[model samples]
Target: MIMKTEKRKSVEDYLCSFPEKQRDLLNQLRMLIKKTMPQMEEKLSWGAPTYVLEGRYCLQFAGNQKHLGFYTSPATIRQFQTDLKPYKTNEKNTLQLRWDQPLPEDLLIKMIQFRAEEVRRESLK
Candidate 1:
């Protein structure tokens, strides 16, 4: 007997699965990550849109019921704890971006850049 495997969804498909507002927020985050690190490979990882560098997770984002979750290394979150004070964060390395609030573009860029550097450093070791 032959069995068929489930098809994995692309980032675009995942984004489209959301409501219009959530989709827009997810797209905006996706575009920002792409613009920040065009070299990083983008794909669905852990059921979210993930950006990879040197085969390591650079960053990931997902649309939640009330907020968009920006995930990265805990170190990155600790590094930006001061800057991230205005936003809500959890110990699990998630930075919550509420739909009602403006996207913190500059801060996101900085966090992604820092994550990219971390990936590079890990690749070296």
Candidate 2:
């Protein structure tokens, strides 16, 4: 019920939750997400940007006044821990990168690419 709507409208729900001024940063993030994980099915999981490959979730995104939230599987985080230092919120599995500043675009793209590939690879086995 609740979660079904969350999953179905993940990206749209998350983006529309934010104000218009923040759309620029969110759009950049969306583009990089697309560039990095081309083959994944993009959908909503808990009203966020959810990318799934072979039925496995690769990542999700959310926005607030302070920062953008990156909700992803811990396995994916551990796989690219070093590259994550700049954006880490240090909250176990979740990470938060700031909103006012420009994100480390290349690194994010890399992380997405790596994570998507990893999830798909594991699901294949």
Candidate 3:
């Protein structure tokens, strides 16, 4: 419900082109994001699906060479550093969420929720 009809269609088409396993993973992640933060807005930006909350870009995700990468603001990176310790992260505060392996669902939900709160705080300032 957070996403517009057109945007949601685009995301569905994009994920459908992948294999079943990949599709399953992407769809699950998409659902988690949408359900966890219904106040956020979803869009396809920069050739990837992005989520905006409280007027700022809160999260971005994309297909990767060997994994799916989820982009988070620097604040989330700093706050979740300990929780994200096991992931292959780049210098830019992006955490690589691998698709071939089972994602740490609980961790992902926490991360997304943290990001949602951060965006709300930023929008207020």
Which candidate number has the best lDDT?
1
lDDT of 2 by residue, 26-113 (tens): 7778878887767778876665677788888778777765777776667767877887776665535577888777878876776787
Write model 3 residue lDDT over 53-93, tens digit each, in one string: 86789988776657878888787888878988888876576
Q: List per-candidate RMSD values in Å.
A: 5.7, 4.6, 5.4
For model 3, the superposed segments whose C-alpha errors exceed 4 Å read 1-9
Task: Rank all candidate structures by their TM-score, best first, as comma-separated numbers.
Answer: 1, 3, 2
Pairs in clash, predicted candidate 1: none
Q: Model 1, 1-125: lDDT tens per residue?
A: 11123454898778777777778878998999999999999989888788889888788897877789999989999999999998999867899999888799999999999989999999999
Q: Which one wins by TM-score: 2 or 3?
A: 3
Q: Ranking under lDDT, best-scoring first?
A: 1, 3, 2
Candidate 1 residue 7 C-alpha distance from true site, Å: 7.2
